[model samples]
Target: MTINTTHNCTEPQSNWIFVGVYSMVFMVGLILNLTALVVFFCYTKLWSHTTVYMINLAIADLLLVLTLPLRIYYHLGMHGLSQVLCEGVGLVLLVNMYGSIFLLTCMCFDRCVAVCFPMSCRVREGRKKAPLVCLGVWGLTIGASLPIYISKRSKASKEIQVDRCFGSFPVYATQTTAVASTLTVGFGIPLVVMLVCSWALIHAITRSAVAQTDLINSGKIQRMIATSLVIFLACFLPYHGTLALLYVHREAVPCSLLSVYHYSLMVACLNAILDPLAYYFTTETFRRKVDMDAMTRMFPLNSQNSEGNNSRAPVNT
Candidate 1:
């Protein structure tokens, strides 16, 4: 089970399974994300802070999914990509991966503000500044990923012939620095902030209905945010954790930690599939669309006008 370090990676028994699973996940993610993009463009009026942020999230998922075909081909056929090509593709995917995480964290924070103190939250609706924020996320992602290009290890090690990819750090210092920075700045801090804010939102939402006008709506949104954060944690924690361990125990690189590392990488790819689900779950408009679809299914002949009147009628009376 000696893991090669160059581009001529030996096909592990698990590589077959990895390719099959990741292929399905990426395809589904691609479709869902594209749908989200269409929704964003076609229904701009329905866009709120959540939906606005979600549009960027969908972009991230789409970009990440786009890179999966290369990976699938490489794994399935043991194709050797040039070092420059591997590094370029890997950097782009890496940016989206972290960009999505950070952006979600930002959205969670924004939602927390809106939920806990709507009067003071002060987020401008329609978010004309959204493009700026997105630009910043991309800039930061590229800035953070610059080290990969500089280090040259992002390309496969010439001696071992196993394409190292992004997480397979060749140098101990570089691996440690990357893992520590990402874990602390990218994941750890964001997770902590989201946990605190989400708990506060829950507390605020559960208070007396009369005391909180938006309690019900806020509760739904908070649950969605919390769930997304939980998925992010579950997916990326193992990948970063094992990578951290790999840094400390470099001797375990290709052989000792290979399986764990590879599995972690697979889980990371699976995030693309789960991320769109998280976005839809966190979005009010998406839920409303789903409810409308369900209603249409339940009453195929009901007119929109009739449904509106029925919705407005007092249920308690």
Candidate 2:
């Protein structure tokens, strides 16, 4: 698969829209994710299985946000950067993207099992294995993303007076295989798992009298599920949809479609910005650490405690 360099391509005025969106996402995502990390490490107890997955998810979002400035620089006409640097940034982005996906999937599974089998010894045992699961997720994501670096072969173009990263691939097989694997492993399987877990969790909560009695906790879990579904649909769905389409029409894709692909990628980056909301809604510790008084003042009705309750409760999910 030969990679086409956009170095000589003229930038349309609309390209700046991407730059602007990235800038906003970088700033907001950076602040929110870092604050979540600080709260998780310094304030919240970190021993829970869900907390382990949440910590890893926050770290993944943080790593991805850290790469935005370079991307912004690239978007702002700073071309001719080292191919190795470009590939490294691409690799980090890919790893973090899938890392977030898999971690969220784990979280859904954890919550489902907890809700469905609260007293099961297996749930307790799973807590001991949480760290290993996280380690495995990191390893899997890194291993999968390594192909981005290995398959990308950069070369200096004397005519353009710069080193072009991902200039071209020697074989289409690598590109085709990578895209297929990513669609299945990175998005498809995870999507299915999340949907199943969410359904099971909701069903368990509805059928169990204990879950109905704890309205506040149940509400938080439902919010978390809704947020996860929205993020996947808004961010990953369109982007991967475009990827599949591009793969199908690789030989005759229009420039407008290419532009749509770029926009879809930008939309996907919004996931970093939205993940912090997941932390807030799902993690009671995070909610306690944050200033709920101010949040309540900002959004009074939505933030109100149930039944005019004055006592603030932590999320127990």
Best candidate, lDDT-wise? 2
Return the TM-score for candidate 1, rounded to 2 decimals: 0.77
lDDT of 1 by residue, 1-317 (tens): 44334222333532677788779978899888886675566434445656667778888989998988877877675545664576677777778888988887777777667766666524545244666777788788778778655765534354454345433443422365677788798778877887887787777767747446743565565566577767888888887787677666564345646567767867887888887777664455554544454445558786563465223111010
Global lDDT of model 1: 0.67
lDDT of 2 by residue, 99-212 (tens): 999998888888778877879997879866988999999999998767554644433322344443323111221268768877899899999998998889778766777776
Model 1, position 293: C-alpha lDDT score: 42
Predicted candidate 2, C-alpha RMSD: 6.0
Number of the top-ranking candidate, with TM-score as the measure: 2
Reference-based lDDT, each prediction: 0.67, 0.71
At residue 88, candidate 1 shows an lDDT of 73
Model 1: residue 247 alpha-carbon error in angstroms: 1.0
* Model 1: CA > 4 A from native: 1-14, 121-129, 151-174, 208-226, 251-254, 281-284, 287-317
TM-scores for candidates 1 onward, in order? 0.77, 0.81
